[model samples]
Target: MAGRESLPLRRLKLFQPLNRLTDDQLILLASRAERRTHSPGQKVVERGVRDGMDYFLVAGTVELKAGDGRTSKIEAGGEKALTAVARLQPRMYDVVAVASCDFLVVEQDILNQMLRDAPLIQADLDSMVDETSGGTDEHRLLMEFYAELRSNQVSLPSVPDVAWKVRRTADRENSTAEEVASAITADPSIAAKLVRACNSPLYRGFNDVRNVREAVIRLGTRTTRQLVTVFAMREVFSTKQPFLQKSIDALWKHSREVAALSWVLADRATRIDPDEALLAGLLHDIGAVPVLVHAEHYARLFADANLLDHALGELKSDVGAAILEAWSFPATFVEVARHAEDWQYECRQDLPQLVDVVQVAQLHAMIAAQQNADLPQFEDVPAYRRLGGLELNASRSLQMLTEARARVDEVHRLLAIH
Candidate 1:
């Protein structure tokens, strides 16, 4: 086996967290990192040992053996390989090469320092990079997009007039259901959808509501306003371009799932408003809407799914916050949009907030879809512990969701209505 003095920067881009590093930072890390290879049956790492280096498998397969005699194999280029092997400070497993293997060894302190400096490094790069010239197509497009967004040149979706009117009417000190219903009736489609929602399985009563006014009474002013906004939000996800339609459809589907899960979690786990949680879940990714809409003008972006996903990952939070602010939504909702994907985010308040509920719900949705490769340990998520500390482990949480599937499905179906 051969060894290299310096790891390739491009190779660093393939791993999580490190993938987030700026090019210059990655180059600096690559120079300090070591690339080593081991033959089959060689020990890569020993259990219960505190090694300050992180081992990333670049090629071939490795096996991890715990003290309990349990073992798992991780192959290079697999989903699990995207992260370091047994990442804890004191190694929890004995790692051995199953075949000839390549691994990049990075000093823990150096890597952590670089990660901490990434934001500052990125800020400096942003100020210096010629957005018009150099860099990949994705980088150039992102720069242009950010420039437009900062200048308010990008178009943001507007909250429907009916939704705004209903919210305003509902917020009145002495407002009646009739007043809120009146505002909702301005948009006949949303009015009809509200009526249908109230009669749906989740909210169904012995007698069906015959009109918007009656629906408003049964669902209450707060719920009526929330439902109106939910119905109106469906329109914001539409696209005229055929190429972007699939992405829009997928986004809508994911939003609905998160919304349903958020509603259930808020109702069962915390005292937070279920309707508000549902709305937060739906709007969490609302920032991506304008990004896709803007991408319609860039043929190359939409054609390359990877580049499009990268753009969404990088820009969605900022765009979402802007959209929520423009819609005059609550600061809480704005916070949800901005930090929904931040697994490390935690509310400083004594109890969980809407953002916490939505974060747990989003992770549950990801778990249900078998997309947990890069996900942090369920117990490690601050939002999850805040919602149900120790009492709710991964298995129990999954069971809770299983029991609530019918309700989640009903909410999903209700929101899916045009």
Candidate 2:
């Protein structure tokens, strides 16, 4: 696996779309690429072992592991981020040799420089991928592809630009529909999408929206801005985390259900905007994505353990807060997402309406989603009893549940899902 046969394993997902598709030039550069060899069962790169330079797998297989002793991803070049992370703080996932292997080691800066000529490399990858098929070695190629998709300068997705702009303008007292329209119009796709959503049953306008300005006026400044943020949120919510699709999807469903229930409950509970509560509910568990997505270890930890350990409890809230804080989300929303479900050790009696709103909303969503089977009884928690204690009495709780379902329907329909 030596000579000039080494290549940087740039998977299609890692490549910025701005580069278009360039795989051929990469293969060309890879042809003259330098190779580093390792004996079978040797450590190519260990977790927490930082190296500034990055390596491309020219040959062989490796397995990725995390701090928790769980195997991360099982591939060769897919395990190289430990070295890349050396450029930062403590390394994330660790890399280990699965068999005898060769790597085309490239400095991080050099790879960045080459990305300017992405079109050529994209072509090479396209061909290489086409030639690759599932069997013995094809598994390696797929794993590499999975890892590459996770690669990027930002390392995480951000809010949509169209939604962000509208929200920024909505901050001021002098903001107008015209201003919001001007912002969203920059992205025609987003503009059209927003108009459609505003006209949907959630907003409940009889007339169809023909333009952004009119839609903005009809939806109001706060609602309009919120809608934009929700639309932008899909990128973060919809990512395919490594080997954790089912887990990710379950979180999404839970969040979405909570969001819907919260919207309805908000109307019943307070003068607060229903939509605001929905937004809060939807994003409450948002932090877990980055934890599971970036770390790669959380999957194994959750999967193997039949019990939900207390140590892992902080993780969901901690990651949730981190995500919202990074997004510059409102402080109140951040608090709810970061702490609602967990048993806060320092809390006293008489739970406030807001905390109770979040706690109850989460519980209702879980029960409705059938995620409560494994969880303990709702009445056991003091806070749970405080929020009308889940009494199915035909008056207050039933009304909340009914309205919650209706609002949940609105959210699902707005997203065009069942």
Candidate 3:
């Protein structure tokens, strides 16, 4: 069985690039890769299906026929042995095994995780993805989407009115805590949740806070602004479209967890404001809202989750950055949204930025969700190392998050009031 599992790695020369991986990372990655045998004259993949899996022929010959009738054969261990699919999603070609074949298949997300952990592999894959995307229709679509957004041809989401008022009021040089409280209290539902949040284990002070003013005072103006903004942002996530409801719900759940974890990490590790991290985490996936909205109008995208996810991966950051910019969010918050998924991204100085806090928090959230089976260890993720200062075992990290459950729960409850 072990030999069977390793066959794909051995036959395709993937073993060499994979040498950059540490033993633990490699084990995690290899475990997730699937090895298969294909009989002669069998189709490996069909054209026009949206798939993000990378496939490499390990043994025997494979025929590739493009949609335009161009054809080529990739022999086992040929010069192109190391290549996977040239274009990831909405496959442009039909691939078939020319003889009994061994094939290695890796999921796109897993490959991304490997690249994130192995910088050398990341560098190579970066070049590969860019080169492959050249002249592709998907590339053209992404560019056109970006151009439309930049030209305001597509309407971007607006910040909730309450979030806007709270943000603008808090931005004033002379803004007082009481004024911040007034802005929050205008929305009675949000005001009640803010009070409840102030009393939660995360922010509870000398006594139970009963009123919005007192809650704002206890949490302070900056945190109040962040809390208000996050509370208000929840309204924008709702959709009347049935197909996107599940995805939107998942997005919010993920966001809330990231926001809670970001607050904890920022409070513990860095000099940056915990509230800033909180807001950053809450809005990290805000770009998906627009994509789902567009998908609603163009119903075809609803039929394929892979295609939708790929589209989100391609456009979310730019769209998110644009939305935040439209809302006049702080430069740090806007930057956090723009680069939420960029784990290798570094800040100007040694101190971790809000972006780092959000990234680390997002990683922790993923770990908790058990969606990180193939991801790098906490120690290997660049954001965790930069923000955490030391590697933490899974147990230690889980303990920290567990201990903060009350606070995290409180944040979730507060946000869910809408």
Candidate 4:
């Protein structure tokens, strides 16, 4: 709820010449939208991420990248907003916000509420969808808008200096929570995001928390400290990069989904630490940032968005591996990152096996969420297959995972992880 300080209702483009909606309903809903900014070459949206309704480019230029790494540029008053054809799938490609742009980020819950109130948007959407077949003129116009954005610079964040110190500790099993907390505290912004999240309604009732120390104590020193680390990471490294931002919402959802599933998977399928698996699931995609960072404006690299998936498998295809290595994630996590897209680890190690459970369960939840293309190769994953083979067990795990996903979706949204 930041910018648009004086305007009544904003009617920015949504793809040219097809679906135009600047109704009072959309504007009233947009009144709830806050302004956000991004720099050039920064990854705005990471693929496979989920986000609520947002009328991006309330100001400034934006580039839209396809799943195959195909890039398109959009200028203000362009075709796509009118077209509504090229909305991003965060679970797939990064949408980098270029040129210090101002965005109108509307919360999902709010957007849904707004949609219910505004019948015109639905009408416009039906018109937009109905008007399309085999790449409608609207979609093409939006794609052209996307083409313009390709050259726009996206804002990306550089890891904080102390991030170097934390990655070093990853290799050590003997490392203590106190050490990590100390490092996290070094970055005030990280401390702030952590403290704010803990204090939010999500955890507000968990305890009568006062400060980081008390919050950490209430959550358990280890869990509390780990949350701090995550906060530090996003704070230090998150930027207005449109490409990276795409999947950020989905990544946040997926991580939480995996965390929820990890607990159940550990309870039923594997012998790994549920807490550790949760950490692994949440951090596994940390490698993605590095890939985007290395790609720069070469949005053309992923011409097929699914190629990013392939890139994950053979990260040698992308710079993800080196970025993970540089980010100082654990060797286990780094190894897990390497095998995350694959069915299993080459060595059949305990961590990788646990990671596989996480990966599969994430895909299962994604499939259930009905948000992506292609099912994960379940047959190839011996562990998940065996787990899935048990009727009662599989049903029970899915039940738990479904409930967890619901809880986490609510929780992360309340926390603004997207």
Best by TM-score: 1
The candidate maximizing lDDT is 1
Pick out the ten consecutive residues of candidate 4 with the lowest summed lDDT.
146-155
Per-candidate total of colliding backbone pairs:
0, 17, 0, 78
Model 2 lDDT per residue over 1-418, tens place: 3455443445422422212324665565455446788776777666565564565554577665546444533344332322222122134556667777666665444455444434322343334434443143433333332233323332444557776677778876798789888998897767777888877777758788889999988988888787677666666666555466666787777777777777777676555687777778778877666655644533322333321222234346644554454355665675676568864321343434445567777776667667676555655554455655334322566566775676668786665431
TM-score of candidate 1 to 2 decimals: 0.67
Model 2 stretches astray by more than 4 angstroms = 1-157, 240-242, 297-312, 343-354, 373-395
- lDDT values of the candidates? 0.79, 0.58, 0.69, 0.49
> lDDT for model 2, on a 0 to 1 scale?
0.58
Backbone steric clashes in candidate 1, count? 0
Work out the TM-score per prediction.
0.67, 0.56, 0.62, 0.48
In candidate 4, position 309 carries an lDDT of 44
lDDT of 1 by residue, 154-204 (tens): 778878888878887887789988888888888989988998998898889
Distance (Å) between predicted and true CA of 271, model 2?
1.6
Better of 2 and 4 by lDDT: 2
RMSD of each: 18.6, 17.1, 18.4, 18.7
Candidate 3 residue lDDT tens string, 1-418: 1133854334434532344455666667667888788888888889988676777666788877766455666677643454453333466578888888787776766655554444322343334435544434433443344333323345567678787788778778898878888888788888887888888766888899989888877887888888888888888887878878888989989998898888877776678887788889999999888877776654532354655566576568766765764465655776788678876777665777888888878877887799786566667666666755644445666677788777677667666664
Q: What does candidate 4's lDDT look like per residue over 278-308, in tens digits?
A: 6666666665554444444445444445534
Q: Compute the lDDT for candidate 4.
A: 0.49
